[model samples]
Target: MILTVDVGNTRIKAAVFEGNTVLENFVFEKNELEKKIEKILEKFPNCSDLVVASVGNIDKQSFLTFENELKIHFLTNEDVYPFVNKYATPKTLGIDRMVLASGATLQFPKQNRLVIDVGTCITYDFIDENDNYLGGAISPGLRLRYEALHNYTAKLPLLAFEAPELYIGNSTTQAIHSGVVNGFVYEIDGFIDEYRANFSNFIIILTGGDAVFLAKRLKNTIFANSNFLLESLNQTFQYKIDND
Candidate 1:
């Protein structure tokens, strides 16, 4: 068994994979890192490799401590990838985006892929049929939007995400809901529409913490899987091993 970990901006998502199949998934905060990994190891004693892709601020030494239990490999931009990264600033690309693009290129094959990750932030990554990693956009996520409204304004309350009852909200809370939820959905659909107009054999992949929450709300068809990153981490590690 191989353990794949994705250290995102807010949470750490880990998964145990047997070949391409995910046996189980785990999510925990940075403070619970060691305890969670110990529990995971206790449950899956056979897990020999700990593959990690971090885009968070947690210290590298924290993960390195696990070196006594299993082989730990951190995936970085320097790692071998299946696609040609054509970003204007290639080094500035996030590992999470790179992993998502690699997963799309390897899993979908010979198609234009647009990967939208809705987590702490909304990220758009596009890869062409020839496996070229073209750059995409980023925007604040739902929580950030809500926090911004509360922080920047004097009276708007900090609200959690809920589908607005009506398109045109009658009350203050409902209006906030309307603007944030409906507006976000519209922005996503609009981007997809623009991309569809320019590309052929295109596939849009929606993943991240909010993937399932926003999937049905989306007007465009998408392949939604919240675990794409962990799966990709496992696949990318295997690809590196096979090719190395």
Candidate 2:
């Protein structure tokens, strides 16, 4: 089994993969880093390779602190990728985005792919049929939208994510619900529409913490899997081993 971990802005998503199949998945808060690694190793002692893609402020020493004999592999720009990154500042490009792009390119070859990650932030990354990594957009997440409303104005209370019963909100809470939830749904569909206009037979992959919550609400058709990035990391790890 291959241990794949994706360190995002708010959480660490890890999974155990047997070849291309994910045996199990795990999520941990920053404080649970040790337990996270321990649980994986305890369950899969034979796990020999650890593949990580981190976009958070986690210290590299943190991973080394574990007493596992597994070989660790961190996905970085320094590693060779299957896609041609065309971002203006390739060096500054987030590894998460590239990983998503690579996942799309390798998983859905010879097709235009648009990946929408709805986590701490909403990220849209597009890769053409030729496997070229082009840039996309980033926006506030559901929590940020709610937090912004509360922070910016005193009257608006901090609200959790919930689907409004009706599109037209009647009360103050409902109004916030409609404005935040519906607004985000519309924004996501809009982005999909914009991309669809340019590319034909495009593959849309939606994956992140909020993916399942928003997937059913999306108007456009999408391949929804919250564990996609972890799967992508596993794929990248396999590619590295095969090439090595």
Candidates' lDDT values, in order? 0.94, 0.89
TM-score of each: 0.98, 0.97
lDDT of 1 by residue, 100-162 (tens): 999998999999999999998999999999999999999999999999999999999999889
- Candidate 2: minimum summed lDDT over ten consecutive residues — where? 60-69
lDDT of prediction 2: 0.89
Question: Candidate 1: where are CA atoms >4 Å away?
Answer: none
Best by lDDT: 1
Clashing pairs in 2: none
lDDT, candidate 2, residue 135? 91
Q: Model 2: how far is 117 from its true place, Å? A: 0.5
lDDT by residue (10-114, candidate 2, tens digit) is 988889988998888888898889777987898899888888899999988778765357888889987777889999999998899888888888899999999
